[model samples]
Every structure is written in structure tokens, then in C-alpha cells.
Target: MPMPASYPTYVPRKQFTQYLDDYVSHFKISPRYHRSVESANYDEGTRKWYVKVRNVSSDEIEEYHGRFLVVATGETTDAFIPEVEGLNSFTGEVLHTTQVQIGKGI
Candidate 1:
């Protein structure tokens, strides 16, 4: 299918990442990095949620309480594919987005 002239038809991976970085920097979106999530639990009595976060560098665990939460991890990842039956009969190989090759003869 042909894309509209205003939209992009093909964009390189590095260029795409650079565009995303530029967007973040322009908008001043400072995202926290390397804060591992240990567990998330909800309390019915208080009607709030507790998230246990552990610092990746210090290994210190701290609990954060919030009424609402959104897990925004894996913004550039492909959707999860569930297991299927008779996968051995497939002729084509499966590859993730990161594993896709670009440019040249392709």
C-alpha cells in the first residue's frame, strides 16, 4: 500500500531513533532510567496502589503509593505473539523488529 505524500513511506532505524530522541529533548520529557520494579500491589481499603521499586545502581527498595498508575515500558517493542500449534511446519523464519535487516538488496 502506498502511504500519503505527507507521511513517510520508509524510515531507517537509526533515523527513527534520532527523531524520537529529538522529540523527547524538544518536549523536555525526562524519563527515569534503571528503576527496576519489584512488585505492584493494590489495597482495597485505601483504594490506592503500592509499587515496589528497586534502584538498579544502589539496589535499594522503596515503596511508592499512587491512586493511579500507568506502565509505560517497552515503547518501541513489538507486540507479544502467543504460542501456536504446529509451528514446525512453517516455511518462513520468524524475526523480531530489532533483528530485521535493512537497506541494500532488501
Candidate 2:
């Protein structure tokens, strides 16, 4: 008996959010670590995007002007973490992708 062609096909998740964080880390570039873009405003006259980036090291702030803005700022940052019971007092292991991976990890 012949089976339908679509029987064993595979379809990957269209959204990267579905993938595990560690898996995404394998492909991240080193030299260019994550820096959250606090805000972005575009200038039509110059065709540049003025982005305010926070320096995770010294907790300083800087601005960058670029012709093209990729806006790689994923959905991770857009949402807020829930504060469950005893969440603040828990000492073991607690981490946010932003605090740990600096926003690069999915």
C-alpha cells in the first residue's frame, strides 16, 4: 500500500520563541553580545534610526544612529515576569534571559 506524501513531513516552528533557550545559544555570536535597545526613533530626513542602547557593563547609556535598524529585540523583553509567592525570597536559582544572556538567548 502506498502512503500519502505528507505522512512523514516535518514543519519547524515559524516563531523562534518555540525553541529552547540553550539551543538558540549555540548560534549566537560572541563579539557582539546583547545590549538592550531602550528606545528607538527614526529620522526620515536622514533615513537613520536613533537608538538608545544601554551598556550592560558599567550601567551606562549611549545612542547610535544607523541607516537600517533590524529591531532584533525579541518578544522576550516585551513581557513582564510574574511575581509568585516566595519568588523574592527564593535563593536557589532564578534568572531572566535579559539578566543572564543579555537578551540574545531566546
Candidate 3:
């Protein structure tokens, strides 16, 4: 995750990265590191999504498939992360439904 250095008071960046590595390992989520996703398409017959990915180092393009996809394309200038001190203890999960939309090419 080529994210530049960030240091939060509660956890050092290295320790945070270690935790991230452990979590990804435990979940069996093998991230396609150092790759750029050019586009994605869904196969209606197979009900799976295929993505065109390019290796940042060699510029080789390859296709990958998955049943579901989570598109977290980094920059979130419009995304807001509000700081509500006691919000964490309140519930299981909080979703702002109004901010979500479900559709093709959305």
C-alpha cells in the first residue's frame, strides 16, 4: 500500500502495517500489490467479475476474477470521516444509507 508515511499517536506506522498484514493474511485476502486496475467487467453467464490489471513495475496487463469487488480507489477528498468521540461504543455498525447508491456504472 504505497501510502506515504503517516504517524498516529496511538500506533506507530510499522506496527499498524503489521496489524494490517496479519488481518489480510487471516482473511485470505491476497491483494494485488503494485498493480493498477484499468477496468472491470462482469460476466453475466458466470456471474463473476473480471478486471484488467496492469503491473506497475512491468506494465503487463492481466485479467483477474472474483464474485464480488470492493472498489476502494484511494483518494477520498469528498468522503468525510467525522470525529465523534463516543461513537465507537454505540453500535455494531453504522451506515449512512443516504450516501449509498446501487446500480451499474454508478
Candidate 4:
């Protein structure tokens, strides 16, 4: 049956944290401990990837090998910057969200 065109589209991540929580809950899997992924490399022979994770507190590294890799890291991890016309030439002041705020009000 043909659906109505007026039906609203359910675009996720409008409210990032809520969307992230919903996505995590949709997959009913639980892990023993939480860790941070440092890097990953593919093993062509095994058709799998070796991922390196770091324990935040002790700064210990752990490796996990798996076939499928899903990047569940949230918006806090990465940033998307658009290329503006004169962005490169303009040498005034530009800061990315990833940058740390040092001082008070500018």
C-alpha cells in the first residue's frame, strides 16, 4: 500500500545523548568492563581486525580481534568541518571544538 507523503521522518541524533542511549539499548549486549579504543589494524590472513584499547585510569593497553568493526564512538570523539571559500587564506582566529579552552571570556 502507498503511504502518505506527509508522514514525518524520524531523523535520529537531533538530541545526541538520547539517540545514543536508544541505539545502545536496541542492542541488548553487555560487556564486562569499559575501555577506550586507541587504534585498529586489519589482518588480511584471518580477515579480521586487531583493535587496541586503553584502560583510562591505569593507562594499560588491551587488544581485541574481531571481523566486524563498528565505530560507536559518539560526537565527542570526532568533528566535521566544512571547507569554506576563504578559510585557508584567512589567518585571523579559528578554533575547533576539539581544542581546549584555556582562559576566561575572550
Whose TM-score is greatest here?
Answer: 3
TM-score of each: 0.44, 0.38, 0.53, 0.42
Per-prediction CA RMSD (Å): 11.8, 14.6, 12.7, 13.9
Cα-based lDDT for every prediction: 0.61, 0.54, 0.63, 0.57
Model 3: lDDT to the true structure: 0.63
Of 1 and 2, the candidate ahead on lDDT is: 1
Count of backbone collisions within predicted model 4: 0
Residue 82 error for model 4, in Å? 14
True lDDT of residue 76, candidate 2: 66
| Pairs that clash in candidate 3 | none
Which regions in candidate 1 have their CA more than 4 angstroms from the true location?
1-7, 41-50, 62-78, 81-106
Point out where model 4 deviates above 4 Å.
1-14, 29-39, 70-106
lDDT of 3 by residue, 1-106 (tens): 3222463546676877776776677669777788898887666688777889999999999888987655564555466545444446533244442365322122
lDDT of 2: 0.54
Q: Which residue pairs come into collision in candidate 1?
A: none
Q: Write the per-residue lDDT of candidate 1 for residues 48-90, one digit (tens) a residue.
A: 6688999898899978887754455455666544344333553
lDDT of 2 by residue, 1-106 (tens): 1222343344244423334343455557233355776786666577676889888876778788876555342466454555544446544354544454433433
